[model samples]
Target: MRSLEVCKCSKTQAWYLFLVLVVITTLSFTGRVVYLSLGEGYGISLDPSCKPRRHVVFLKTHKTASSTILNILYRYGEARNLTFALPFFDHLGYPQLFKARYVKDFERNPSKEYNIICNHMRFNLPEVRKVMPNQSVYFTILRNPDQVAESSFSYYHDVTPAFREAKSLDRFASRPSTYYSPSAADNHYARNLMWFDLGGDHNAQGDPSYVNSTLQALERAFDLVLLAEYFDESLVLLREALCWPIEDMAYFRLNARLRLSVAPLAPAASSKLRQWNSLDWSLYSRFNRSFWERVARYGAVRMERDVSQLREIRRRLGATCLRGDAPAGAAETVPAEIRPPSFGTAKILGYVLRQDLTGPTRELCTRMVLPESRYLSLLQRKQALIKLPHNMENRL
Candidate 1:
């Protein structure tokens, strides 16, 4: 039997080996590197002895880089053959308070313990608790309210009543009162959308006591809250929390809008946007501070090093998995199978895998950039097969 072992190597040797790995991955070579336990010198593993956390609940927020994080969860869970608590359709009865029944398997098997829950939903803690294990770690992501509003307006221009009435993000921000009404249909997307997604009242006044209490409640609900602007740092902290290897967290950005589609908010408009979404603004501001504090506790130098290592791995993966060998490979002509589901006017981008990729390489690369809708469908089918009757399976 052939045996391979890891040994300490110089920086130059490590870099050369990394290049070789990238080439092998790109060519879809079957030759495997049995093991390489690179310590701090090569910047790979944080704690090899620690078991990777399996049970997790990721609250999928909208327009805050949440899709990218969701892709990470998808790859991680699927690779391990772990069960996901998926919704009946795309989301868990989103826009309504989530219940245990919103999960596909819950009605069929209430006692089933899901290894993951990362679907979009209006979070309801009690209902979530019914599906996920007691030890499941819960986390979510947040973005600046200004950015969220701009992205939402562009993405939901036709679907959202306020966005359609205002016609432009700036116009909506300038005199939101004219376009926005609490009674308007789908108005949650117009203001404090992040807050609303977290099961908070989008139309609530930002009274000091109320906002403080809401923040306090959130503090208890989630194990970690990631900020979109500081996504890399967030991942570093996440890796630590879950005791996961760095490569497990690598991802390709999904559901990203084309540059031209993004409508930039003027400084004054940005301020007005924040004001219009005061509840979300308050939520973001409070957590943004705590995120930094958490990083400080993790050590600034160590955090920076891990983040850099993660970026390098991401770059290498992009070269191997995506077309054009760019860090973010844009699909030349978006394929129908993988094309992102269109929402109003925003044209979300997808990716193309290199033609030569085969076997496991192709599978890994494909999942890395698969559109969320397609991935969800694939998972649904996979879970259904798992639950299928054994005699019925033989017929198929």
Candidate 2:
């Protein structure tokens, strides 16, 4: 009788412990679900006091070290717990889509305004006002047209299949007019120089109408303009204008790779490049003069001096460390071993879903999803996953 009683007590204790474990597991899952549903959107503070109250828009151009600046802004946003009107797609091309009321609708519940909005958006004044109604600051960088053309040509030639068949740079440089004449899908000059920065179509010839439009926009919308050639100086002015932290002004090196070199261009080839880019040179010179005039009128010198003082402060704070051999605005390279794989359909879908979701639910869903093959393929190719078509999905 005593033996039987002891066995019964042991069985009851085991059942109680099992019940407790099951309850704990269920509670853990429920807590996660609740956090996902309510917590993520409120996690970041987009209040005006965190940085400055005004809207800041950066016109990101190719090969102008714009990416480096964007990275800094992104970091600043993160530190301040602010949110960017990050594009649904990989790049921001259409300004018409981001109107003031549209942005308000996009940011429906937050009740707060955006501190900064920067992306690869086309230059549109009325559209910009729709999003940033008050005293918003607008800025962009300009590079020497000749250098811009050369860099753009080389970049496309190395990366795109259309340029791969060209025998030499001379062949590519021979036809400067065709480089940006709508036929070239990789029309960097047309896109970066004409539409986005200058607010005009490249097909039109020598109309200062675009220039006038840009100037008017500056008068009405922008407080500052930056030159890519003088990037350090540009950042200094930016720092002073925004009264940003000194560390924020420091340049970051990002997105660069060492390449094997071909022989130096012959004198004939060099001259060809110059001859081909005559239109670019002319436009650059014309715009540059106007840009300087605007700067003078705005008392940019005083801004520069203020920036210099801020740099000194940053130097004292030990945040002024310079990168070795890295070009301005390049990102640090990840080691091959730890780097994520390429993008594929599933990855693209996952990215889109994450962007679509709001609050804690989005965060939870993002964490729960498995690493899809599409993502791995995209990482390997270094291209936007969504750009690939459904027909080619299997190729990834």
Candidate 3:
């Protein structure tokens, strides 16, 4: 009977130990989930990495906060050390038709694989397809035509011959045809730039058939179309579409022209601007609704939660990556690395990185503020070094 009691006691102790182990394991798992929630996205799908989508084709449209999105892509791809279908020029033949020939070091039956293709290219889907993988996710951003035109007019005043003598957006909006000419050089900037950039006829006049066909084509070809106005919500949906982690989506505003230099678009001016850029207006109006519907599919309530979390993360990152006590509106306030090149007569905003950081933290902070031009240059240099003979790398 003593032996029987001793054996029963041993069994009871073993059961208690197993129960304790189960409790500890459960707590540890719950703790990890909690920790991730605090730093990453709230209300995001539990398993972001279950099946991550890496290959992407982001059409970088101009004056639509596309630069900021590019920065996000650049950081994510760079972090993973993923290969890029880098263009021979600054971009993959931007403002010109994208071709496989535009991709640097690309040849017939090239063996190297690319994971990301985010650059300014006058998108030609077939030509673009030859560069990236078959499974690459396609996406782009669009902005309100009035706002985009206002920005483009301000930035491209000199480059766009149409805006040269117009002097101001209001003046151009007052009598647009007086200044705008189809025959003018860089006339695309003065017209339906987004449509032109997407390989559509920017000059198409009141053809709903053409517009509908183009929209359908875009719908079929691209996985997502982000709106610059609803940028945060778009980003949340993008996170869902790409199955990207919250950290990969964080970004700082890039290429902001100082507000002091820009005037508010009057209601009438806005209307006139939209009327003048009818094709872009139509595209924006159609897609804005569709984009919202896409957000709803992703769950607007959850999207709101994620957006709030994303903002919080951006705020925290801003504090970490940028120097404080700098004037918000001054051109000289931030360093060149963060600042985009000034356009025409606009005072474009930039940022200064934190001075006290070093090592990986330092690199992260610096890159957060790096300009698109410098980032491209840096990326290209890295790529060049990568292609060099291992024995000859020291000479580089």
Candidate 1: worst-modelled 10 consecutive residues by lDDT = 29-38
lDDT of 2 by residue, 228-311 (tens): 777666776576567664445543333222232222455676677555444445545655776677557547766566456544
A best-first ranking of the candidates according to their lDDT comes to 1, 3, 2
Tens digits of per-residue lDDT, candidate 3, 1-396, equal 755543555454545546655644432212122224335544355463457688999999999999989988887777666788887768877677878788887883366688898888898999888788899999999998888888898889999987897888888988888988888878889999998889898888958798899988988888889999988888888887888877667777888887787778988888888888998888788788889888778776777788988878777667766777332543564555555688887787777777786655666767766788888887786666445342222322
Give the Cα error of residue 136 in candidate 1, in Å. 1.0
Write one digit per residue (lDDT tens) for candidate 1, span 1-396. Answer: 112222344455556557655643453312122111212244555576777789999999999999999888887777667789998899999999999999996886799879999999999999999999898999999998888888999888998888889888888889998988888778888889999999988888888998999899999999999999998999989988888777777787888977777878899999887777899989999999999999999998988888888888777777777777532323453455766666787877777778787776767777777788888898887666455343332332
lDDT of each: 0.80, 0.46, 0.77
Per candidate, the number of residue pairs that clash is 0, 24, 0
Error of 3 at 331 (Å): 3.7
Candidate 1 pairs with clashing backbones: none
Sorted by TM-score (best first), the order is 1, 3, 2
Which parts of model 1 are misplaced by more than 4 Å?
1-43, 325-331, 390-396
What TM-score does model 1 achieve against the real structure?
Answer: 0.86
- List where candidate 3 sits over 4 angstroms from the true fold: 1-45, 108-111, 325-330, 333-336, 388-396
Top candidate (lDDT): 1
- Candidate 3 at 205: error in angstroms? 0.9
